[model samples]
Target: MFSKSCNYAIKATIFIAQQSLQENKVSFVDIAKEIDSPTAFTAKILQILVKAGIIESVKGVNGGFYIPKRKIKKTFLVQIVDAIDGDSVFQGCGLGLSHCSEKHPCPVHDKFKSIRNQLAYMLKTTNLEELALGIKSGETFLKTL
Candidate 1:
């Protein structure tokens, strides 16, 4: 449902949030490993998240990445999705038509639109805090293992 990079971003952010609740900073290697993503790609995604103000990076021998306390609840999943994948997921056609729209609908346009609306609603309403809590409680996870 999301690009590989966006998937990694969400996973990494949620993991970082889970760590932040315990007042811990996570290194790039740890984040990548926890999310099952490539280290170099995860580093690049972290750069994007930092630039977008969704996460913070500290510079020092013991420095690492963390989401700020102020942002823990304020940062919604949509923000991360937007920062990494832009608004394309919400705007583009499910059928991959260059000009698909209500005016000239694709075969699955209406159904796709309904599904997209639900996805957008979930993304906008679900904050990282809730997801982190789920992870902490063992109700959810970044990876199967």
Candidate 2:
């Protein structure tokens, strides 16, 4: 599972992507409210995403964060996760064993392997634009279970 920061980053990214279609930019406060995230935490994640080149930002009266429609194809969920939580979520052992590997497999290594591979594939294949479109068209569902 992803961390809170990663979740916040994805939500904020999706919000920005939605806004990019109409608004030129969006303020941090507005993004936080839109995604129901903490203002300060979302701002930090946005800064990280901007620094990673996954999103853009400007400073002025009209300054805010926005994802350029041009670079949408190059941005992936993996990049956002890495920018916020590093590669540990994808690379580390699912069973929490420090030495788990092919030769010295953990108890749940084989079972987790398939799930991990699927997760990695999803992260690599999904982009902000697709998610944004899903949001706009109501193809994506946002609910808490």
> Positional deviation of 43 in candidate 2, in angstroms?
1.2
User: Per-residue lDDT for 38-125 in model 2, tens only?
Assistant: 8998888888899899899999998999988877766889989888888887776887888999999988998898898998899999
Over the stretch 5-92, how does candidate 1's per-residue lDDT look in tens digits? Answer: 9999999999999999888999999999999999999999999999999999898887899988778999999999999999998997
List candidate 1 stretches off by more than 4 Å. Answer: none
lDDT of each: 0.94, 0.85
Segments in model 2 whose C-alpha atoms lie over 4 Å from true places: 141-145
Clash pairs, candidate 1, are none
Q: How far is candidate 1 from the true structure (C-alpha RMSD, Å)?
A: 0.8
Cα deviation at 22, candidate 2, in Å, is 1.9
